[model samples]
Target: MSPAAGFARTLRAEWTKFRTVRGWVLGTVVAALLVPLLAAVSAAGSHASCDRNGVETACPEPPLGPDGHAVRDKFFFVHRTLDGDGSITVRLTSMSGIITYPPPDHDEIVPGLVPWAKAGVIVKASMEPGSSYAAVMVTGEHGVRMQHDYTGDVAGRPGGAPRWLRLTRAGETLTGYESADGRQWAEVAVVRLPDLPAEVEIGMFAASPGDLTVKQADLGGLIEQMRFTETTAVFDQVKVEGAAPGAWRHTDVSPTPGTNPGEVHHPGSAVESGGTFTVVGNGDIAPVGTDGGMAVELTLTGVLFALVVVVVVAVLFVTAEYRRGLVRVTLAASPRRGRVLAAKALVIGGVVFAAGLAASAVAMPVGKHLLRGNGNHVLPVPALTEVRVIAGVAALLAVSAVLALALGTLFRRSAAAVVTALALILLPHVLATASVLPVELSLWLLRVTPAAAFAVQQSIPEYPQVLDFYVPQGGYYPLPPWAGLGVLCCYAAFALALAVVRLKRRDA
Candidate 1:
């Protein structure tokens, strides 16, 4: 027979063998059904309603991102209007706060501010959540940082005594500086806020990121409660050199009082006490919990669980033939062992890809509908992004199926192949996302292992313009979407090559 004719015959034989197995067919159906079912269940239960002292109330309209998640932008502002380009210089004397945890009913007095707790000088275009702005601030323990919009942070001094901070604005560019004396300064960051108004609010602001406490609701849903804490910053020699208009005005933009009423306490009628002014406030200007709304974009979370079924079926597809001594028949018929293995890989990969694609296409829309039906918000993404996520998921499962089949061929045992496949493709993902390992090690695992394929389904992206948790746990990928998927494809290809070599050399 011709080489092409032999390959065609091998392909036909493998397809017939795969179809003849009822368990493998059922497993594929189960994988397709389970992903959408789990996604719906998860979405339906993840609704977050506002609660005050354990009493559910009307949730005020949450500040949501493109994907529906509660965002933090509310903070106390003590500002003076600057009519033109200029600078504000102040000495941060001290920062201290009280953090109270619930249920445990205990208070931990922090000597300094908490991480993400900020006291700084800000130049804001408006007091909107997603508006453009630049700030030079001191965080709790993370030291001095220059932050802008909401997402970007530039570190300065790591940790030390209070520092003298200055923000100079020229036209559209804003430069932040840290100084020892009021004279000598070290430039920390320079950022440009385009289309800035001729007049902007420039002043001292203090905000403490609300304490996030995770709890289980009665409905088997996850609840994230944000408890507000008061943050105080003592500023001395508060001086602004620009077109200033009169006295400073204080504005408190805290969220509706739930557990704690947010407030801003300014220097008393005594004004500057010995050239020092104090400001105290509650509420956060950082991104808050998504309140289960983020669950919609994470439709792929169910993929990990569904993939186990795929791996088992894939391994059994090859190894069952070995156990029944049917492989000898298959090899004897085709006589080209490499072609036989290739045919099996192709059949398994194609089946998984089609099943996965159908599951994801149904899951995304169904998940979104379930989330909204449960009174939860769903964040919108571009059509292209949605298409990529669905397509990527299908590709991920197909590649993983081939990998499992390759392992089965090499091992000639179903259990070993399934375990090895799981270890290579799933364990690293769990460890990385769970944050059990150090970040460096976790990142390395995703970078080098088949688990990197998970990046293909990641829909949320890191924005330097918004401040939020950017980690694997938060749905951020270590590698670019396609690049990460490419890693898994490479591994699958290598495994198949090895399997072909072993199959050719070993007796069936």
Candidate 2:
């Protein structure tokens, strides 16, 4: 055969060999079907919901302020004080909030607020002395920014002081604390108000402004039960002489990152009783809808498809020998063991490359289409950089294919080779993410692992050490995007070399 003809013959043999294997056919079918199915299921199912059970009602939009230009929306829950005793309880939009406290004189004693963005601790109050003291705690990026002794006029508060509001940027958070007398401190209120132009009011509200009869008495009695215990506090300032000052209830708030901006300012579950217009809070909270499922589903589907491809390729390569007892027959034909091995390597490598190309061509657009229509379709407009990402996926498939071939050659046992390939691909990623190992040490291992090879798809620049999150050690390897992919390609090359060497030395 001519060189081109010889390559064509090898390709033909591979196609014929794989076609006869039922497992290869089934595995490919499953891969093609499963990816789309998972994507569809994710789109249709509930990623998350604003599940406050019953402590509050959604607020409606009010008029925009003089300077406010609809930066974000806020939700609020309101309650009337039928008696001089009531407590308020509620959670953040998604563990996102900045809490401000009043001076002890306001009866906001032992003031506390829980984060509504993610799972976080309830920051209780502590204080020092000054005029109109404030304690602020923020949960997000720049965590607890101003959570110190805040002793100044309420004007010094966040939107200005003395008002002390918690603020957040994306997931970053800041906390500010203030106090007069610098001793006892009272939580004024936790603010979910975004720094953006929009305004939002969420959570429960209650009022205990003391009994109508006690309006003549001290404000302390009216401000006694100013705590959130069961439902969200809708601004209740009532008090009973004997209760624990106020109640504190805990609820899970890691889910609701915020609400759909398109759905804001609708109607009743729309307007606030506080009479303030609701606005969008944080537009930056990620994984839209606060549902962690988008990433989870995507990851699972990709991994499943990759595994199916690997298994099918391994089976195709191994079963060919089983059907013809090719080991013995080929050995007889070649007499010299090395020649038989060379033919197998040439044949299998071609098959794996072709299969990888076919699988990748099918995966990309299909996966993206399956993901469309769901709000999770973040990359609606593809960028030039996306071409690199797509190419990375294809490269990953090709490398995986070649690795599978090498594993099959190394062990000559389909199951054993698949397991080893999986370990090689998955374990290192899990370890790297854990970050338990020192960066230098872990990165060294990452340099060698097939998992790190995929790092080439990373388009973001890695921060250099000293200014970056980590410093590099001597000889420690962490490749840049292209470099990382190169490392992976090198591993695949080395494995292929080993396969060739063994094929030359071993029996069929």
Candidate 3:
């Protein structure tokens, strides 16, 4: 017989052995069942709502940007209609802000800017939230930037006040320029808006996001502190080259009041005197973070619980044969111990992969329904991303099972193999995510340990432009999804290699 046919027969025999054992079959079922069961439990305990005009209401979904993604569109505006091709120019003299209830010294509201605070000039599609727009701004600490459509940001120069900014619109394109003396200008950035309107709102704006501080909580996990903040900008030498030059209008955007917790309406204001403008505004214009909604993965927190059952089943699949002295009989039939080990790995890995995939597929939609029913806001993701998450979860379980089966082969004792496998995978997950240690150490464990594979479930990305508490406990893993999964794959390959050597050199 050909070697390929012989190996295929061995593979089929290994699979047959696994199914004939009722305990293994039942264990796999239980493992798959845990995913949705625990998902339901997690969804049941989760809840959210908003305070609207002294009454509670279901939290509103995040405003979708022109790109159809969730975005934060809360900021003050001093704008006027600009018809056709036009340009708006302004010189910012000073930019400042106030932070309410700052930590450590929580006794006083102090004067400051929280790095991302903005004072700028913008030309927007309309007054509506999350519409298309472009702006050239002087930030609190990030210097000057040209931002558009909530996600596009290009840096221009590095200073605060005494900066001149210009936003010009010609047809569908927008260009930003910056200067120090308001004479010689340097091009900052140019962006072409798809289907830009002939009439748009052009004006000055100010915004500051809440000040955030993260500290270790006494009860466990990181405690994020958010304090109220507002920013003010003084603009002089303001100029507009189109429609009724100085006809500016004041408007406060929605979500300014009667929404969100810890938010008390402080609708921004604008004052105009002798061609100088002072704009004061609170809130931010950027992509919404995890604070906006629970990630789809949060619905699959059950994956970890499911992983425990998979580990045990995989360990016993190999070790049970050794305990009954059946491994020797199988090896005699094959006359190739290495092929026998390979066959067992393939059989167990394939079974766990199918089980995990099925569990995740069912868990995703069902858990989402339960979560939404319980007032949990789920962050929406791209269709491709959703598919990657589901497949990745299955891949994680499969690789993990292969690793346990190899350990079972090496140790020949189910208990020691199970304990070791669990320690390698589960302990790191608990220590890193349970907030039992410092952030630095927790990050290190997740990056290096087998538990790093769990990064597959991270749906929300960490945006550098948006300031928020990012930690493992918040579903923010240190490594990118596939890269972290690679770490575990490397471990499994090394262990399987060691098991092959042991089987070749030692008695079964």
Candidate 4:
């Protein structure tokens, strides 16, 4: 037979053997069903309700930016309408904040600035929250930054307060500039806002994100709390070109409605005296995920259980042959023992990939619907992001199956192979994500182990501008999606190579 035909026959034989086993087929079906089934159970267990003076109220939907993703758009804006293209220049004389419940002593309130605390000149699309905008800003400790549309951030010159920040708008394009003396200028970055209207709001703004304190929970994992904080910025030498002759409007863009603008958490205000403006705000303007709600990936919590099923099936697919002396007979028929391993790997990998893809596809939308019905805000992501996440789930399962199958072939004992496979893949993931150990150790495990492949399920990215608990338990992975998956791919390749070498040399 031709080499290609011979390989095809071997592949078909392996697949036929897999489907004929009643227990294996049942296990695959059970694995596929577990994802959405557990999602339904999870959704049913969660309940959300709000009450104002004993009156029931619906939960608030998460704020979404122009790009149709979750965002936090709360800041103090001292703005006026700019007819068309214009520029806003402001010299930030001082930027300071009050931090409540910061670390070391949770009871004491202190004066400080969070690293991301910023005040700057901005040309925004409107007073509406989540609108597209750009700004040249001075931060608390991150120096100067030019950020736009919630996600775009570019570093400028290194300076805290007393920074000269300028933002120029020309049609849909915005350019940011920083200066030491206001005479010599350096361009920070030029960004385009595709949906910017002819008229826009140009202003000075101040915002501070809450202070997050994290401690280990009594029962493993982390417990995080956001203590309310506020920032005040004083801007002198304020100049706006092409602004309409109207009183500058001040808006406290707050996430909580009916929240007292002067309250400790939402203490937002604006004052102007003799061309100097003072703005106080207690919120953030950046691309945000579902910090207050559950991530969509949470519905796929059943994947871990499904993964255990996958590991068992994959290991048994090969080890059963060895246990029954069928592997020797198969090797006798297919003298190229490497081809036998390749065929088994291909069959098992394809099965798990298909099963995982179907399960994830069903779980995602169904789980999202259930979550929303349960009064939970599921963070919105782009359609392409959803597709990538789904495909990534399948890829992760397939690669994991290949690794398990290779381990089975190497050991030729189902119990030993299954235990070793789970130790290499599942146990590390459970420990790191559950955070049974220290967070630093958890991060190290995800960075170096096969468990890193789970990063593929992360729908939202970590933003430098937003402060949050970025541990594995918080749904944030240390490595990028594709990079993390590649770690598992490497493990599978190495194990499979060893299996191929051993199979060719050993009797079985």
The local lDDT score (0 to 100) that residue 461 gets in candidate 1 is 63
Candidate 3 per-residue lDDT, tens place, 270-332, comes to 999998999998888898778778889887888888888999999999998889998889888
Tens digits of per-residue lDDT for model 4, 444-507: 9999999999999898899888888888888999999999999999999999999999999889
TM value for model 4: 0.96
Q: For candidate 1, lDDT tens digit of each residue in 1-508?
A: 8888888888998888888889999999999888899888888787756666678864555464323334566666778877778999999888877666666674443444556678878888765554567899887777888987655678887763377999989999999998767788889999987767878888888887656666655654334555556678888888899947687778765444333443322211113467676777666655443332463457656788879999999999999989999888888888878888889989999999999999999999998887776666665555788899999999999999999999999999999999999999999999988756666787899899999998887765665423344567667778999999999999999999999999988898
The lDDT of each candidate is: 0.78, 0.38, 0.87, 0.88
Would you estimate the TM-scores of all the predictions? 0.77, 0.45, 0.95, 0.96
Order of candidates by TM-score, top first?
4, 3, 1, 2
Model 2: CA > 4 A from native: 1-7, 46-300, 319-324, 330-374, 377-381, 434-443, 456-478
- Candidates sorted by lDDT, descending order? 4, 3, 1, 2
**Which whole-number lDDT from 0 to 100 does residue 69 have in model 4?**
78
Candidate 2 C-alpha lDDT tens digits along 21-40: 78665665555455445545
Instruction: Give the Cα-based TM-score of candidate 2 against the true structure.
Output: 0.45
Off by over 4 Å in 1: 1-29, 52-55, 61-70, 101-110, 159-161, 195-199, 210-228, 241-244, 255-275, 289-293, 320-336, 377-392, 413-494
Clashes of 2: 101
TM-score winner among the candidates? 4
Question: In candidate 2, residue 436 scores what lDDT?
Answer: 47
Cα shift from native, residue 251, model 4 (Å): 1.0
Off by over 4 Å in 3: 243-246, 260-265
lDDT of 3: 0.87
